[model samples]
Target: MIKSLDIVSDLGEGFGSYQIADDDSLLQIVSSANIACGFHAGDPRTMASTVQKCIANNVAIGAHPSFPDRVGFGRRGMDLSALEVETDMLYQIGALNGFAQAFGTKLQHVTPHGKLGNYVVEDSKYANAVAEAIAKFDDSLIIVTLPGELAEAAKKKGLRIAYTIFADRAYNTDGSLVSRNQPGAVLHDIDLITSRVLRMVNEGKVTSITGQDITVKGSSLLLHGDTAGSVQMATKIRDSLIANGIIIKSLNATK
Candidate 1:
């Protein structure tokens, strides 16, 4: 049984006046914040502000890099070369790291956002590109990803890996996330979400969409901040974990 774990959320996804979620409230609950870098759904102001909030809440900061697909919110796949992937990852990480340094902290981890995130899991080239970027930028940075190519690449680069499990997403039998376009891909039931988290932490098992029981030993639990009622769901999951004698901490602390 897992005694401790990190709870992370994708935050700072709003651009200008177009806000997505209640980030301030989320900071109070999550142990880590994956702040977006301009490419997907954030700007300079948002990154800085989110980093400041994370510092205040004692939450770890992580870069959430994505393809240059603001219109698609980084969910749609792009046909970029390996060099493009590497450079984009570096650019995004550097931007967030600057803000993190200014805020009296450094980035603790990196998690690819949206389609890029999915691609890296299966595509060796994308995975290696991302790993190369992180290793060049900061080899000490932990890579938050599922168990796949990205994880292997991080290991090869001698970087730390934090296997993450999604609290609100459905998984396929092959351990990939169900497409958002599919029905029931994103879960909204608080009771169900909390229960799944509990089982994942304590039992290292989750029932996939295909009704197959899959093993998942995750060091962190990912919660999406932009989903409806997400704050409440996060709060409930946090409380449930604590009440069950599971410790909630930042990824850095866990490491």
Candidate 2:
């Protein structure tokens, strides 16, 4: 079970000033916002606008980088190496950091987009390389990853880690996320998502698809803004956590 409650949102492609319907609502609720860094989604304009909001709310901003597959939306896996993943992540973070500096905010962390995130969690070499990239780019930058393998690997590389659990997403029996290709991967039931987060925050465990409770930590939680009830779900999560006396804060602030 996790010891704290922190919520993050994946802002997707509506970067800069672009508002693709109800985007700003979740910004106020989540403690962090994972803004797209071009390859998967988002543009310079959208990135700039989202940064301003994050600054205003004191929410931490992270680079949600992915393989250069805008057409696949960065969800599908690609043939990428340790070196390739590191460079790609660096490029995206550097781009956003450039705009964030203009708004007087620093890029606080980096989380791999889609398949790359899952990849590094299981592959030690890939994980270390990503961590090395982050350290080389700026050791001060935090890395948000899963609690078990991914978080451990990042920590081994001497990079700051923000252990995270997905709020609106479910994990398989083995702790990997339920693949999107599978029918119940993305949660539409607001009740289910909010309940899962509450369990993670209070119990420090997650009930995998096999109905087995596995120990987990919840340093940071995510709400995929691209998911259908994400805005409403994130709002309810914030309210519920506060109702339970949990503090809603960005990973950096709490750490």
Candidate 3:
């Protein structure tokens, strides 16, 4: 059978007058989108417009919920109770779902944003909270994340899981992503990124920052639209994957 991959990107990360990536261009390249939901970088108008665009481009929409940190772009960590995390996530998901409903589509998945994403990988409490929120909102929604506590919690809750690998980020020896604060954490070279993606999909492995080869599921590949030259890199990676006979699919169609 031919192998399939899901290409996703974070979009709608704009507030009032400030915009972050060329979402329109990136939408054409990605099969799915993790749209920022107010907390990190989106507003009511932006969310509605993004949902419409996703429908227009036939891209699956997923919620990219984050801590209430617009200034830090959800990259900074916040300490909160389990209840707070669960409620916050539910609020964000509900807000985005409203837009999706208005646009005649629904959320295909939920992926934590920035620090919360990292936390879910390391903290079971946060993982459980997130999973509970997703389960309560809609058990059918897929949880897009790396292999970790979140995945485990989602499995326990009977929610579908989509293991994702970052196309523009570096990995650690333990299969976790390297911290963005570290040097070389985010990749920029087009050839190198594409090659890494190919190896991860074809070989189920990626070279870590420590020069060690690590195993990965790579069910989905995430591309950050805000990164420099991200559009070009995404286009090249998609073309290369197709050239090699790998099918590009949406997360909803992966399973």
Q: Against the hidden reference, what TM-scores do the models get?
A: 0.98, 0.92, 0.98
Q: Rate the local accuracy (lDDT) of all candidates.
A: 0.94, 0.80, 0.94
lDDT of 1 at 195: 99
Off by over 4 Å in 1: none
| 123 Cα displacement, candidate 1 (Å) | 0.3
Q: What are the C-alpha RMSDs, in order, of all predicted structures? A: 1.2, 2.3, 1.1
Better of 1 and 2 by TM-score: 1
RMSD in angstroms, candidate 3?
1.1
Per-residue accuracy of model 2 over 39-104 as CA lDDT, tens digit each: 988898878887898888878899998888887878888877778878887888899999898988
130-247, model 3: which lDDT tens digit per residue?
9999999999999999999999999988899999998989999999999999999999999999999999999999999999999998678999998999999999999999999988
In model 1, what is the error at residue 112, expressed in angstroms?
0.1
Q: On a 0 to 100 scale, what is the lDDT of residue 108 in model 1?
A: 94
How many residue pairs clash per model? 0, 10, 0
Q: What is the lDDT of residue 207 in candidate 2?
A: 83
Per-residue accuracy of model 1 over 1-255 as CA lDDT, tens digit each? 548899999999999988899998999999999999999899999999999999989999999999999999999999899999999999999999999988789999999999999999999999999999999999999999999999999888789999999999999998899999999899999999999999999999999998999998898899999889999999999999999999999977834
